[model samples]
Target: MFPFPPSLPPVATESAEDLAEQSEIEYGTLEGGSTMAFFRDSKIETYQKMWRYMESKRPSVFVPTIEEGVKRVLEGNYAFLMESTMLDYTIQRNCNLTQVGGLLNSNSYGIATPIGSPWRDKISLAILELQEKGIIQMLYSKWWKNTGDVCNRDEKNKDSKANALGVENIG
Candidate 1:
């Protein structure tokens, strides 16, 4: 399960050259070997500086509700979700696949959940409402596509498909 709120790793104080050398030694790079040699020769402070620089590039994350979710989405607060595992997992659990699919299909707004549980239902309904607004679209699954149904029918169809293929008679 993803944590409710994600925590990023702290920036290390060590230098890039040191980090590179450590990475090289830990991976066992010989004197002339290609891989580790390059980083091993770099200054440790260089690596540390690079780490801090990258951390500084990250945008602050915010949690918003139905009233605020749309606004935040429009503002790009959920942009990190594109590459963040924690954010993705949280979205997956709180928002069903259909809702997320709809958001992806829509071009206007972004998606973000509120800080607590009270907003879960509201967020979900808001996504649906957003779809109605033409700002999003809730895509149905393959099964739903063919039959206009959302419930899984795998088990119901299993016996027929198996019998037709003669799998039931197999030893």
Candidate 2:
């Protein structure tokens, strides 16, 4: 019988093809079940695409909370595919886990406004102004990169390359 943490060889998870192979390894075994985790309620298009990708390959678990998925990965033999932002936050806090692979797709966040609200234009303009002045970028660097509580990841380590996930090793 396969062990709880199966004795699968280390497989590359840095590309879509690699991830597909990893999923195959997990789902091919007798005890294999749910080697990937996705948040159950996410309606974002990119997230949905990832869900479809994984589901098409094999069945995986959906966790109600992000914390559950994080915990599952920590327990081993699992991968949690999530937004780079949240993945960065979690990796900074928990050194045991690092992001695997780059983003499967790209998306942008928008400031939500009530329907027909007059403040929408004002808020949109302010966000654009911040972007133009690089305030948003500065804030992201401060919180995501330079936080005091963050784990000091080694650049030489392959898995620690979370920041450049989208740019590096695109295959």
Candidate 3:
């Protein structure tokens, strides 16, 4: 189905603009030409650049949610631009996905505790201790890399009850 070169067009070898132009040339917009998709909800500035690029070929191709965007990428002819952490985690979990290029921008994340919460410092210290002991990296490898086929990815298929990701959800 791919009419581009033997190698993928989005490789680190070319600029983002070049990739878009090449794909636009090969597939043409109506034929599901190569396109960049992003989480429509993202407020990040660099992501706006991506939106501009997508707009050039065809604006209607954008996906409204990260989940839907990822699905479209897998379905073909679409490349989903996402935050590095989430993208890396998703790629690690799925053997079929590969990152085409380096990060366009970077952002730092922290373990946020509400203002004046007693657990703030305690949580920070705990994270530091875990990092010092390499537990964080170990967990990253365990969850992201090694899980592979051993883990069931569909949430509905899980046998155990699952809790949501907020402190309020903890038992």
In terms of lDDT, which candidate is strongest?
2
Reference-based lDDT, residue 16, model 2: 40
Q: Per-residue CA lDDT of candidate 1, range 35-79, in tens? A: 223323434444344334323432223222332332333333121
Which order, best to worst by TM-score?
2, 3, 1
Error of 3 at 48 (Å): 5.5
Q: Show where candidate 1 strays beyond 4 Å.
A: 1-51, 57-74, 81-85, 93-171
Better of 1 and 3 by lDDT: 3
22-102 per-residue lDDT for model 3 (tens digits): 443221112231223232333544345445555665645555565666666666666665566666666655545555545
Candidate 3 stretches with Cα past 4 Å from truth are 1-7, 10-49, 55-59, 150-171
10 residues in a row with least lDDT, candidate 2: 26-35
Residue 43 Cα positional deviation in candidate 2, in Å, after optimal superposition: 15
lDDT tens digits, residues 14-88, model 2? 544454444433321111222233322335444455456655645344454567667766666666555566766
lDDT of 2: 0.54
Whole-model alpha-carbon lDDT for candidate 1: 0.29
Q: Regarding lDDT, does 1 or 2 come out ahead?
A: 2
Q: Compute each candidate's TM-score over C-alphas.
A: 0.16, 0.65, 0.57
